[model samples]
Target: MHQDLITLKKICKPIENDLKEFQLEFDNALSSEVRLINSISKYIIKNRGKNIRPILTILSSRLCGEPTPNSYRAAAMMELLHIATLIHDDVVDDATLRRGRPSINKVWKNKLSVLMGDFILSKALINMVRLNDFDALKQISTTAEKLSAGEILQIEKSITRTMTESIYFDMINQKTASLIATSCELGAITTSKLEEDRQSTHSFGQYLGMAFQIKDDLFDILGNESDTGKNSGGDVKKNMWTLPLIFSKNNMTRSQYRLLNKLLNKKRKDGHILKKIYHMVEETGGIDYAKNKLDDFSNRAIDSISSYPNSVIKQSLVDLVGFNVNRVK
Candidate 1:
């Protein structure tokens, strides 16, 4: 994992510099009468994330042709939208921690946290309008809607025992993958005139996003809480259906299914029961099966990017997919 981060640093150095510049611009752009909004926004920015979405946007543009001012703007917009979603998600999840730190709702009241999320989302949309690109605005707006719908679907299905693999895939695709696909497509569209390149870039982002989420699902079952920077077995606690749990349930005997169903239906907090469920999932090859699916999605991501001309940017994008697959937490 250490070596992978080092390699990622080398691959992402140039893009990181560009991303930093964009971040500066983004910080400068956030001005409003709401001082509390600014404070919350700054707090959110203080704990920097992996910047995967913005990096993808910039790198996709460069791989298609050359980086431009428009690409930088789009990248900044993408990050803003993502951060806003995180704020909203933390609220929805009633999560106490995010990225290993106290979540906004934990620090402040839920009302303030919810308002902050709305403020950030409004800022992102305003910036998108400033870009004055109808297509970009439309794409981002649609992605945001899909993300909302997906979240609702997941919440509705929480603790459901009958979730199918197809439903799980569909949920992740909408919840996690669509925004990523938009980032790449918007990046290419900002820098390139070729429709084919734009489509391919979107495909690359979609596959990569799928792989990324699948890895996250695996981590939920197998990762340490400290390593993942979130509560381990959070999905299990929420009774959210994921690929691993779905596969494991399918392979369980009638008696095993009855036991698992009882645990799922308990509606009570019990660590021992959760651990038992985790062990059952592992014994059923749930984690391994999810990993294999991640492998397939990662390969598809690589293939989607392979169509582009060779460059450091392309290689970096490919390496990102590799990192996503191998990431422990």
Candidate 2:
């Protein structure tokens, strides 16, 4: 196992029992009488990645106050929503693998995958209603809207090929940061119900999420499929502009810009073209620029939580931020 993953386990040691309870709630929430749904749900459970959102939810709750049954329910609901999004995303991307296993669409086909995503979304809704917290419901509903809007905006930018640094940050803020922000906020809502705690954790999550998305974008250029668990250069292949490419575009000479445009216009790009693009971005310091932004967001995330008194949970949250920055996958 990667050392970062090992450190993650240690960071979660403070909330191990809380995580176990959350697992029980999460498993219970996925149950269904329909055989196909059950089978798909089992497969999802088996193939799920590190339950990062739930961990954030639970840890935030602990940070605010003692964990409650409602905290677990909120955690489970967040995980269900996250899973539903992934299922839909795979279908949209025509992806064959997820978390290093055959994607739902690959095994079950797109139609079934879409339906399964809906079913899981319905389950998430059920969990939300079970919480009976109006604030939680409202936050999650808004987050759901943001998630859809973020994805739609990405698709629009990809089609128009008009992505900028500001727009890139905006798209990721909506698409990725919103859910994580809500995850932390929900924890405070379900536990301490303190506005200060809520604001701090939400800010923390938003910053961390921004950094997280940039890291994933970096992986698209620099990481291999084995390490990333998804195809590298996917953004380049799809003509989806990410931070490195976007930064590099500003620095490119007229001839280099033409070459980039030529490569992007191609119906299919060979590995040689891909390698050249990678080197282009690297030489222009695009990778370093993105890394600097990532570190900025990470430092801001740590600063967001500095007001909280020191504790194992507080340190765990701090470690979580570092873990994200250092994570290879």
Candidate 3:
């Protein structure tokens, strides 16, 4: 993880100072008169994850042209929306941990967690309105819709056990990729009004996010809690068969399929069963298959920005592809 940050250090340097300001704005945006809200907001500020979304926003702006005065504000809104989703996600998943700390839901219980998520969403929307960029507003609003719809879709698939390759792609695209795509689009529009550049950056973000989510899913199966800073295989425990599991199931023999299905149903929550499942996934090339897909998307993302002239910012965007796909956490 330290090495991962090192790889992105050059990438993030271009916007490092701006990101600091953005962080301050992010913290300030959460301020409220209410007592519990302030406490929860402070906790969120303290335990925030890497501000990758906002950095991406700033870098995407630099890649196209000079960012507007509202660039960081747009970036802050992105982070706010992301944090809100995470707050809600923990409650829905009943997750006990986030970034290796006790989750908001765990510490404050479901009611406060859900309300905090709502508060963040309201703040993001209010900030978006203040920005007064109709196009960017539309982009982010569409993203908010996708995020909610995607989770519902994933939960439905998990409940019905009807997740196909196509549905899986759509789920990840909406749940993870849409906001990233919006981040890039917002940046480009804030910097340059050129529709072509905006579209191009949005595509870059979408492809990059696809790879990013799949890589995360890979970690969900293979990573340690200490390394990933979250519950490993929690998705599987909830019957959310991600790419690796889906591919591995496809490769199983009749008896093996029966065994795996039975184990997943009976022992999905069992940590002991995961080592065996991981081994089976590896032996059957499930991990290899997902890695291939990840590589494909990473390359696609790079290609999306290839038209941009060589520059520090361009190289940073390129480096981000490697950083995201290679990150273990």
Point to the candidate with the largest lDDT. Answer: 2
**Best by TM-score, which number?**
2
Model 1 per-residue lDDT tens digits across residues 1-329 = 56656766877876877877777767865667778877877787787687788889988888888877778888888888888788888887898878899988988878987888787788788878887888788888889999999888888777445578888888999999999999999888888747888888999999999998888888787776788888877887788987899999999899988888888777774678778888898898888899899999999989987767787888889888888877665
Instruction: State the lDDT of candidate 2 residue by residue for 1-329, as single tens digits.
Output: 78877988999999999999999999999898899999999889989878889999999999999988999999999999999999999999997767777888988999999999999999999999999999999999999999999989998999998999999999999999999999988889999898899999999999999999999999988987788888888888899999999999999898989888888888887778788889989998899999999999999999999998999999999999999889988
Q: What local lDDT score does residue 271 receive in model 1, on the 0 to 100 scale? A: 71
Q: What does candidate 1 score in Cα RMSD to the true structure? A: 1.7
Score candidate 1 by lDDT. 0.83
Model 1: weakest 10-residue lDDT segment is: 155-164
Instruction: Show how many residue pairs clash in every candidate, following the order shown.
Output: 1, 0, 0
Model 2: colliding residue pairs? none
lDDT of each: 0.83, 0.91, 0.89
Among residues 3 or more apart in sequence or in different chains, the pairs in candidate 1 whose N, CA or C atoms overlap within 3 Å are 159-239
TM-score of each: 0.95, 0.98, 0.97
Better of 2 and 3 by TM-score: 2
